[model samples]
Target: MGRRTLVAVARPDGRYDCRIAHWGVGADPIAQSRPLGTGLTASAARTVIDATYDQLVVLDGAVRTYVVCWLDPTLSDLDDVVLARTADPDAFRRWWVERKDEACRALDSDGCDPATVRRALLTSLRNRASSVHCLDDASFLRGDR
Candidate 1:
């Protein structure tokens, strides 16, 4: 099987506070966003790091944009996950679906909607409490990288 993928979405507030749109599990604690700031908040960053998932997706409300991040275990550490600026809702929707499908297959589960899977992924990531074991964001983005 392939590597499982998880995604989380956050609305822009000049800070990263993403919501779990679809997680591959039950919805209890839900998903929350963490801000990227100074190192003084190492403890807080630790909390976020402790809650790290395989992949995270943030949406900027003001700019109405989306950004993605992921931890590739294959790489030995978490790398920045970024998405190009897109205004087309359909394009984003399609992209979400494709990735969600691949993720489901990797996890050996039935494929679900973008929102459902997104929420589930977020939940799964929280439960794991570690960066994704092995993920390649570039490959996921290009569909062939």
Candidate 2:
């Protein structure tokens, strides 16, 4: 994370407010909350943020993970945040896998076909959203996501 970055907040009117602000005090030179845009839809806000900032975070209720655009290709496996953050890694892993499998089974019951599943799986393996939406869509096909 940088000293200053762009952050967005959803408003009561179902729009977004984006700004370039620092997390520090005393009016830093980096940037101020100048209202990058107002009355913007979520998608338009995302587009503005993508064009203006290198990273973004979801700060609706809690401090969530920031954007991860690039990673060292030499790493063997990316750590699952649940496993990495939990006190009991083994227990959390079991529970996470079970819940994931259950969700996949439910999706399978929802009439998702095989070819679509394969395509979704491939897409997720390539690049995925933080919430793992594509992987969720394809997890039922091969019993994994």
Candidate 3:
């Protein structure tokens, strides 16, 4: 099974380079506005993140925004979120690769797979979130889509 967690990297300093994106609640946890490596830098990342809030469009309050806040690396020895709800974030990436592989298995099929199209849809989302929400599901791999 694949697990999805809000991913982040630590700088030499105390601040973190966290990816800011929205993970929808209920049904499908994977929603629009997924991260596309924008938070790799602490300096310019914030400016880019602020743009998300400005561009946000709420459809009758159906969509909510959340940031992936990793557990502090300094407080613990673990490099990543030690007590993540599911598997490591890297596992999530691996799952995407596997899914794409399966989808491309058919010789008759052409164009992009679900994962590829998803990565392409990555966009800026509202940033400066105060907390993290944990809601992960691997249903898509079970042919849920």
Candidate 4:
């Protein structure tokens, strides 16, 4: 599969959370696909996403318009007021990954899958953020349309 242009979000640990952006199939996480070579560490994929964003759209404007704020792992309130106005993929990654890790730890099962936990987290967050475009992934992040 060829590596297509995508809206990639940065994780606090420097890993990118990449996804598809078109066909109305938004919010589809592509990290597991491994077709785009997105598994490469921070700098490699960062350059890819950065270049894509910088060249395709105004980098600063895109960042400002499409914001993905990762709420606290322990947060029960998913209000928009609690969300950040600016883009912060690093913070989102930190909170999201940490929450998934924490949930997996609490499972205490023999075969607890972290990916499953992450999906659950995404579902829950998506439910709470149905009104606004959270831009948590390329699929969800759209301003150019």
Top candidate on TM-score is: 2
RMSD of each: 13.6, 13.6, 16.9, 14.5
Candidate 4 residue spans exceeding 4 A from truth: 1-61, 64-86, 110-119, 127-145
What candidate 1 gets wrong by more than 4 Å, as runs, is: 1-18, 23-63, 69-75, 89-145
RMSD of 3: 16.9
Model 3, span 1-145: residue lDDT tens: 3223232334455333443334323323335335445324444333233211211111111322232222321223222211112223344334434543444453226554544433332211112122222223322111112
Ten residues in a row with the worst lDDT in model 4? 51-60
lDDT of 4 by residue, 38-125 (tens): 4444445333443122111112123422223333233343431122222443444355446656665655554555455545665654
What order do you get sorting by TM-score, best first?
2, 4, 1, 3
Q: What's the lDDT for all of these models?
A: 0.33, 0.39, 0.30, 0.37
Better of 2 and 3 by TM-score: 2
What stretches of model 3 exceed 4 Å from their correct place? 1-87, 103-108, 111-116, 119-145
> At residue 33, what lDDT does model 4 achieve?
26
Q: What would the C-alpha RMSD of candidate 2 be, to one decimal place? A: 13.6
Question: In terms of TM-score, which candidate is stronger, 1 or 3?
Answer: 1
Predicted structure with the largest lDDT when compared to the true one: 2
- Tens-digit lDDT string for candidate 2 (1-145): 3334455655677666666655421223124455667777766654443212323433344333233221212222232111012223235335444544544564568765544543443343334333331211222111122
What TM-score, computed on C-alpha atoms, does each candidate reach? 0.24, 0.38, 0.21, 0.29
Residue-level lDDT of model 1, residues 16-123, one tens digit each, is 332332332223213432234432221232234221342333222222322233322222344322333334433543554465456656444543454554456554
| Model 3 steric clash pairs | none
Error of 4 at 13 (Å): 34
lDDT of 1 at 44: 30
